[model samples]
Target: MSQNGLRFTLDVDGLTPAATAVARFTLYQNLSTPFLLTVDIASDRSGLTAVSFLEKNATLTLWQGNTPLRYLHGIITGMETGENNHWQMNYSLTISPPLWRCGLRQNFRIFQQQDIRAISTTLLTENGVTDWVPSFYEAHPPREFCVQYGETDLAFLTRLWAEEGIFFFDWFHPTGPDQKLVLCDDVAGVSTLGSLPFNPNTREVSTECISELHYRAQVRPSSVENQDYTFKTPGWPGYFSHHATNLNGQRTQYEIFDYPGRFKDEQHGQDFARYLAEGFRHDAETAACASNSPKLWPGKRFTLTGHPSLTLNREWQVTGSVLKGEQPQAQHGHRGEGTTLSNRLDVIPADRTWRSSPLP
Candidate 1:
């Protein structure tokens, strides 16, 4: 009959060492027209245990209003672990006497959830110009590390890296003979890495030798709203300071430094050290608001400070539905009740410091 669009963002952080996965299912319906059912299903996985070279499985179903239209079954494989892993499926069916006025529904199930230590957000650049990278560290050492960047999804990778105190190498396409490598240090020192001996036509690092040897420094994005904001460390080496704020000019989040190395699980010493170094003091008043709602205001502003590290893989999605009257439809062309599922996964090495500021 009719269809409506829906947008959703599901963020799951894994605290275990085993691999963990999540799924999302969607159903659609239109009450104004005759019976026409449509269904879409998707899945994703994230966490430390999700290796890049592994196969995974997913299940999906669909329903019209209340009656079953068709049943659909399928599997998803070749899932990689990191900041983002995803799968999707879609199908439609026609009921024997199309019913008018219907609705849709979806469900998701995780087959496993162990060894999935630490899951966070995946960031991407807005203009598709740059990429995010990640460095690994041990789960137990001390010294907090993190990253900060612009408002683009690309910033999420930096945030994750800042929290984890990891590093990432990003190879960019050489523009001209005057190609310059500008290394911006936490201090005010800016050094040039010089021009490439050979033209690197693509934005990829041609050789590990050349790329690894290039000038390396923590990369930070310039602030648009506050030009006075600096990307320098206060008293720490290889670290930077940053501030986060909300629309009301309230400082909701902030970061001090990023320590390089793994954490040591000695008598909660690592946790205490992290709490002292990479932690941010949330505004009690604002934090109370976040605890009360599932939705965030569109213009809310967040601050971050750190160096460039890894990038995350992310996607944009919207949901829709098809249905007849109040009956349910089936998925695909099968005669069973309809269902849907979606999942995502991220795997960080155990030897890394990934920490996040308090939410305000």
Candidate 2:
């Protein structure tokens, strides 16, 4: 529905973004780092101000009327040339989340009997994060752990939750006013787009809503079983090694890379093993689609009705989205309302809903 409903700004670089007639944008959330947004600009050079010199860490915000779709507090991660198609020069820019910028700060610390929740909160706070909450999922039975010397914020956070089968994701401030670094447990954000189970017995299904979808199933290799993984604290011999059974019925032994953090004991090793197995047991299903649904969003659940190959009525969660569009025709020297809305989405199988619902 973005035929005439998209506005954007990059105040960080003092950019006066007049209507560039030919353009496209891609907005991302939840699943990836730098929860990026891509801007594809195509126009005559005379009407275009050079945005290439925009500082690397400038903020970018996208708006639909007064409502903001993305508030990326990170930086301008990338800027490049796209194509000089049909006498038009195409250029692109990318914006990332704060997490990506966190890498510039590195630390070596120790935590003794600390709650993972509290640990994360303190780190987030020191990192300038405010306003946040969590769902009810315990990553491990043990409450404490320690990170080794010289670890980046992103690496530490990702590793800590990954061992517990939790994918740490950032959430946006829904109303577009409050600025906070929200870390979600497993889902996308504070939205109801696909936050529930696909109950086939009830609920009306929307048909032909998706214009394009690329779906795939993936399996982990049996070679992972060729090694054993371990985690240990000081004065301990390390927890039991995790074993993986190959398809031929023989257990393959492999090594889990050294963990920078210290685990309490063998019990924690068992938990880690379980996480590894769970990763192996599940066959990965991924979806990337293009749709015009402005309401379609990440971390929300919805159903599909008219696709031939895709499973009909199955619960799908948006892992991420790229809200993009451009003016169909070139407004060469002057600016006008030529921007439209086209969204690109990444989705997966969803199990449940979020704690705080989003505006429908």
Candidate 3:
């Protein structure tokens, strides 16, 4: 008869109080990517008249408690209308961070004499995200590379950060009501991380069947086809070349990236070369599982039990997660019964060197 914990609040830029039609909204949270809120309004559309007031930089917020958790503010991108019947009107709005818009724009021009951190910080600031912060595992010095012309910002970020073993994500502040940007790195004993003090023992699993777990791994041992290789900097002529070695077998594919700048000397080349060699230390792994109990986050480790094979079970670190919850049809505008937070997480083997340090 009541929807106690399934309530949410939506605050638009100009709106005095955040808005939410209790039984009409569903929230979706994914790793690193922004959270999504889908609001369906039936019949009268007077409540959402503010949709016309939304502008490009307008902010849209989704929250549960006075304090935000696993949820943050999203920017208004679009809206649509649907007709369930002549008298019933259906309206929907899409909200997410400005990243979705800015990420799509092509790089205006090539950058010069800039480091990776510099570029990343600039991009973050320019997109209206002034509070960009990196965890300690991200201590590596700014890397130098020549970016090509006409590339999208998101593409550049994915390519550059991947090589450096870093990722981009957003999380709400523990103390404040704002979403903070995290430039994370996958380094063991170097980045900030904390243990889950709440459930010290193995958390309950949502899916009991052993078939619920999925795993895939690709590894290539050191071999001729997978050996190291070198590439000369485009404009530098014979002065410098970046070399990268594959710790696995011969590579079936290869790519040569040109950052926006040039290496000042051979030492720079050597450092980049070492980066190339160590970049692929971990095998490409894909695994996922569903859980209705323990909530998961990206870059954190968890354990699994009851796998038929020993090799298939152990401590696994989460790489991504999708948190979902649903309730029965509305009773006086409230969802009931099914709102306990259903979640699915993608995980990988916890390689020692890839674990993050204690969290701040």
Candidate 4:
């Protein structure tokens, strides 16, 4: 009759401590995208009668026994109050990472002699983000010139990262109560979450197991080819292309071609072409699953076992997840065992190379 390990706590900055609990929550986390956490709160006091008095940021924490499962700290982008009856009032808030603030403003700026990493760092730091790490397996040469072109900071960063096969995810700080953004250009940068078992019996499995799963394979473009023009090499045609070798003869004749590859040299063009090709092949072989795991998120790898198919009983990395949890409405509240958690996860094989799709 107790949910001792399934308690969710929310603390708003500058808001006096009162009776507040997460009645329900939906958290969306994906690669190369900012995380969004929307929580329905039950509170005893309506001290935040008006949005004007609400704090700018808050910390949402989930606990399992004596250990904290996750600590999501973000800016309070939105708030809503509803159904104020008696002592308990219901409200909802939309929380997003500090990086989300970049999307609020547009700018026209030029970055000279800076690489993608440098430009990203400058923008992130300007937006008060100091806890970011970049993990690149290869080198990125400084671009002679780059223009923001009336785009928001988030859009600009997204374009640059997509072109360079870079992606980002947030990870909880080991020794702190916050999360740090990690940008990685290689799959090696992703951390592993050990392993979990797949149990089809949702009625009799632990909270950390996958309840249902599906494997997907589709025929996509087998190759990507693109051509770009450089003023320095006016007469020379700048063409580069790459083909996928992991398609296993599934419509290998299919090709993807494009113009204006946006590279300055042959090597750069080839790299971009490879990244584009990999992007198409990324979802060619994937696994979608439903789980009760609270720790699974993007940029992390986990091994799946107990599956009927031997091929699927391997390590996979999460690319996207939609996590939904609801606290039991029983009188026990925080100590109720009826609390439920469900998550839809999208993952790819651990050995496959992952790349962000190019933005239009």
Q: Please report the candidate that would top lDDT against the real structure.
A: 4
Q: After superposition, how far is residue 74 of candidate 3 from its true place, in Å?
A: 1.5
State which candidate has the highest TM-score: 4
Worst 10 residues of 4 by lDDT: 328-337
TM-score comparison, 1 vs 4, better candidate: 4
Stretches of model 2 off by over 4 angstroms after superposition: 5-24, 30-32, 40-94, 139-145, 177-180, 186-191, 194-208, 221-262, 265-267, 280-283, 295-297, 308-310, 327-337, 352-360
For all candidates in order, the CA lDDT equals: 0.23, 0.54, 0.49, 0.81
Estimate the lDDT of model 3: 0.49
Q: Report per-prediction Cα RMSD to one decimal.
A: 22.5, 8.0, 7.3, 2.5
TM-score of each: 0.19, 0.64, 0.65, 0.93
TM for candidate 3 is 0.65
Task: Write model 2 residue lDDT over 199-229, tens digit each, in one string.
Answer: 2222142321566667876554332211233
> Per-residue lDDT for 163-266 in model 4, tens only?
88888999886444777898898889999978788887777654478777799888888999999888877997888889897786587789889797877777
lDDT of 1: 0.23
